[model samples]
Target: MRVVLVSLLVVSVTCLPQGAPPTVCQTLMPFHGGGISPQGGIPPYSIIPRRQGGRVAITVTSSLGIPFQGFLLQGRTPRREILGEFDQTTTQDGHTIQCGEPADSLTHNNPGEKNSLDVIWTPPDGYEGPIVFNATIAQSYDTFWVGVESPPVDISRRSVINDPSFNIPRQPPTTTPHYARPIAKQSSTEFDPFYSGCAVTKLCFGAPDNCVINKSCKSAVAVTVSGDRYEFELKADNAAWVGVGLSDDDKMGDDSVIECVTRNNRVDAYMSWTSGPPNSYGAARLSNPQLGIQLLNGSVVDGVLYCKIRRDAYTNVNGKVFDLINEKYNLLIASGSSATASSVSFHDLSFLASAQKQSLSDVSALAAASKLLVRLHGCFMLAAWLGTASVGILLARYYRQTWVGNQLCGKDMWFAWHRTFMILTWALTTVAFVLIFVELKAWSAEKNPHAILGTVTTILCFIQPIGAYFRPHPGTSTRPVFNWLHWLIGNSAHIIAIVTLFFAVRLTKAELPDFVDWILVAYVVVHVISHLVLSVLNCTAEKSSERRVTSFPMKDLGASGRNSGYNDRSPDAPFSNVRKGLLAVYILIIIAIVIALIVITALAPIEETWTTLKSTVMDNN
Candidate 1:
């Protein structure tokens, strides 16, 4: 019986079908797992499983408009040493290459077209069972200033060829393999072929011959003139609304804008209008209905959001679009956080105007000139003139006489300090005027309020030093005329400086952060109070001198002067009781103003409040 049983078992094993092994259906199952997505990525990761030699295709699409720039796919097998994959991703030029090891590492240069990258993965040969595949999607974050990897998304899938019973078809060569394209350098004389539309005749992105003149835009943009249409690429560092506006004037108002806003990992395209003000975007979603504006694609990768916008060179979309042909106009670029997309509170704004076709040399010269102008104007207005002049005035008015009667280097401390401050102010004013001339390139006045005020202030300031040089000797008959001229010119210039500063603050309120208004207001209050105190002191001193002079009898002038100590110019002529009381009041007012400023600055919603001010008064009314 045992011999018969063994013989029957052997026959049964040998009789099994020789064409195919037993099927392990468990090795071929649908992808079923939790809702885990790669780090920094939104979900719905499409993973297609294949039976042939354990191959799988992984595709990740952003739920938001954010484009996928790069990704890392890792396969962990039961046997670590056996882990292997042959991967591929298409480039901008439609060429594909081996994505090796950590998969798609080299393809970072070619970001996905519309926020998606197809990753082909093949597990190691001869290894079967189940393999866990994990991925980390990479894209730009925080204004495209930084790149971050998404958290690992892990899922397990069965291998197809693990059982010989299942047929594993060969994965057809989906794409032809090609060598990687080299990055092209921008050359002034030659246009690089890296850009699609930017041929010799049509300038594209990355081409030096691209005729677009960049003025104040903050993004990496490339604009080209192609026949009846103008094509452009706008790139920024983070996920937000980035756009370009075309205007007949340099101002942002009355312009048509092409915009892309990235949110929830998807980018939305729009055609917007600046019909009224910067805050009023007048945005409308652009879909199949063409208004001469077209969005080729939008993608976000490595913290950068890239949007390709196209429009006819000339269009009459009810005056919504400007002509971009041979005419001169202004091109502006602006970006806002997602929260301010509707309001268009762009944190970044850049502009260039008087744009026309230019030669390479002309473009280079213009670029250098623009840069120099920006730096010079910025330094003069923000630091040199505004900052130094304000400081000098404050020091001369407040600190100069704070140590009255105190001597330094055998000179009156007040006089020495005041002279030093005034000299500094004069030098700063000269430099500021030179910078303004250099920036503007001409002496045309009344162009704007800022220019007019600046010109007047500069003229008044120049007269001060000349008047000082012509000052008459003390006690001379001409001294009173000199005094009056000096006082009138000095006070007039000072008042103009204050007004100019106010106008400057108003003009640049949009550029400044919210808290700057509080700072400016505080300084203005302090400055006015200090000037009042100085005026009152001068009046009181004049009254005291008159009293002393009238009280003296002409016949007994020497005795009266000696008794009243009027001839002394020493430290003993310290502030009187009334002057001391005035000083106390001045100090109290300054302290109170400073405290109030601090409180207001701390509590105010600077940007919002600033917007309200503009809308209520400066902008609308």
Candidate 2:
């Protein structure tokens, strides 16, 4: 008997499960038809007095998944009518009603917490209930102020709450492709029961309610079945914004795994039939249901599980659905265990009819603004670059003319032009940084990535000026070191600046798509060609006089360990070495770009573009 008792004691302790931690989301003051007050009072905009069928419910369970014995849900409005009340013992399939005695056990309570209560209510009556609310759950959401204190963050907020107030727009009378051939089908499957998170179906309206009001009715597969699917046809008088619902998350709460597609204006998704015991089904008893194509104003006449539509909202680009959650959120599931989403397919027949295209002038405000931004910066760059080239060549020509007549280059010439170029560059950079920062400060879902890239680019550009300090005064130790530093900073600045340019293009609203790199490539080409043209013209005209004698001496010109007599007339001039070095740098940059492109291609799925390019290459070959 002692040996058996000892073994049983060990098993009991070992088999005990650890209690779950309390939710980070604190309780929220219940909302009447009105908003919640800070001092725990209901507001005037809340449910009015003596209305019927208005109900709200709150349930507070112990952290250990045990019930608060004897504590029942209880709430009454000023009218003294009970709108909602929690049961002392609520029994579900496997759960027993309050079978344990009422005890305030600190062991199952959150440390340092006060009273634990759930507040559910039906307005005082006569009120239509709250239309929209800015309620704080547990965490702050977006820029919308939840409160000074963080809101109770809801892990999964579920509700069987239904609103009959929606007038769901009737179909617009018109002829469109959506009304043509349509595929709406259903499969033989049962609804799944509700569990932990997500929604489960029940006969909320009762069987006699006649869910369909004399419309096309179909049954489990044929005659008529009162199911959860909503059916309607819209002319797409506007766009469709569909919400996703699922099972297994917090009961009555949202499944965070689903996210809106990038092309919000047009969406496509596959439907599930009996996916993993969906709201009502048994394993091997059902198949994963399939969804036929859906158009903007068409019908899901076939009773499919999912529908596809071309939407009107276009801000969904670049949005990711929970990919970074595992690293950022503790509650996230492992990548291998979670559901793998099948790619959705949608075909919009009325895309052309419902499609939106704007005139150049309509978008000119932004296009003009983008051009102004580039012009605001580019014009300055062109002036500084071409102006410096102009002044330098002009000064060189003037000095050559003077040398032909037996004179030396002027002393103040370099200082004057260099100071002017430096001042102009400084001004352009300052303006660019200030304006770009202001533009990027807003948290726009559509433009945040571009804004971030712009900010980074602006910061890198500031390095160019720091590098310029290396050339404080020419004739320093290896004057060329300053030149090299300046060159490296300049090249890096160009890369970052081009990155900013792309962001700008992405942020600006334009009728036609504009790629920043392509624009930059064009701008740089034009700027360089202009500089080269001016230099060559000046060089050609003054060649004869350039050979004229100068007192600076041939020894100094060739002192850098490379020589070319001042009067040398050969195919390879010494300054030509400077030109060759510049060309080589450009070639190296292109080689780097090619290598980076190859690496990026290998890392990501770029098969679509690669296949097209390969086909073209094959055709050319």
Candidate 3:
């Protein structure tokens, strides 16, 4: 009887399914223990949230339409604590199990393939913190993934907190608040409460200069002073982190930084210090217990990260003291896409500094860093490369023989016009190069090659006129060498300049639209077609019996044009009228393209400009 009982126990153990154990309540990991690693790519499944009445209805569906066999889903807090309860009666193809709390986790009840699963979740009463739905999906016993999360859904509280009349209880200086909830009023017209009383009741700073007033800023910060306590609100759209720094100067190093970072679907406010360039080292978090910074409320909803923090008016960080009432400081606002548990990634999306330092006690609008110099730099470059340089090169290449017997200021018409346009190109490029250096005040920290390429193009352009002045005499043995060198340098500079403009679109400071590339492509197409037509006309002129007037001396002309003259209105001039007509058409097209590009450059971030203009027109009407 003992042997029969032992044999039955062994048989039951071996017959169990090789999947997640039925006791997976806390660790959420599957029981497929063969030392296999989970998949590293994005999971094929996603959790979709829909608000039905006061409760949330969650649906787990395959993002790529690939059916899943098993999954474990739960609602988690920022601290990784389980919250709320899942209704087992309303769950489809799944059953609720307790994970530290009653009915707090949901998992597959059967191994059958399912397209989706639906469950209703009710938040704990009076809980206003954010909740994220995290899941571990299993396509098969061995193929599974862990830690897939959905966008956070914020729970509404019974009372509003951002009202001006609401008062917050002060805590000890050494103790920072962890999860204090402040509910901002939400409406269709004014969805964010942070913008209320900005620049009037509090000092506001943001990018794009006047975006705070226009209500169109992607990132912004506001500070309100009440006696020894300073309340700060940081907000940004489509960002993982947003921060504001207080610096004595406009630069970033050795500054006091207040950061609002979204990690695990919740926003946490922390104090940090900028040590150097972001490429070398990002802002380092301060670990002092006496930092005196408190996070009042924070939430990450629909890709927007919002945080409200409070700090003592007098506080010390890393041996440096900040006196909010007596000290003046520049405000720097920056936002980026990513952050780790300990450090934030580079702020590549937006970085704006105030025009001047101001006291925290002052409640007024603050101006952002001036983009006037940057805009001027872009406009000058467009005028140089697209307008002057293009026209100069065209005249030198194709119209040299077309404007026969014409004299402008004692020089051939083509040569005179070419020299004028080339001079303008040189002047404009030099000024633009200087303007950008003045605006940046140092080397660009961006990883793109726009600065390096622009410098090389300018160097080549500067030498062109100098090289021409020292050209060898006509018909000399070294004249051919000079001619070829000039052609090579000129063409190289022009091509490199156009390519540099393409890189400029990606520059954060330029703020140009992506479709600007299509405009550039159109210019190239038209320019090439014009060149082809001119080349065909030149060939026809060469094959005709009538001799054409050569721009150079007759000896330098090709064998077919050895009989050509250098005087205007020569009876032997071939197709002169047709060449003149084509030149006129080409000039008109070049001017139109250059004007369009220059206007776009001067008014970058064109979407905002259009909106502002449209609003103004409606107001005027």
lDDT of 1 by residue, 474-539 (tens): 555665566556656766776676566555533321133455556657667765766676555545
Worst 10-residue stretch by lDDT in candidate 1?
A: 15-24
Tens-digit per-residue lDDT, 273-364, candidate 2:
21221232111111222222123211211221212222111112112232221112111110011112343222111110101222111211
- What TM-score would each prediction reach against the true structure? 0.39, 0.28, 0.66
For residues 1-621, could you state the per-residue lDDT of candidate 3 as single tens digits?
Answer: 999999876644331233344476556666554344678755656565654334666766653446677788889876788878887666445677777778788877666666666677777768865677888888765688888775456567634322333222322222221232222323221324456566656788876556776677778888978787898888888898999999977766788999998876456778999885434435899986227788765655445677778888887887899888889999999888888888887776777889899998798778776788899999999889988898898887766666556689999788899999999999999999999988777677667899999999999999999999997665556766676777789989999999999999988788788988988888788778977887777677767745544434324432222232322445324666876787788778878887887788787778767777887899999
Residue 48 alpha-carbon offset, candidate 2, angstroms:
40
List per-prediction Cα lDDT, in the order shown. Answer: 0.45, 0.28, 0.74
lDDT for 155 in candidate 2 is 17
CA error at residue 37 for candidate 2, angstroms = 46
The number of the candidate with the highest TM-score is: 3
lDDT of 2 at 266: 28
The TM-score of predicted model 1 comes to 0.39
Winning model by lDDT: 3
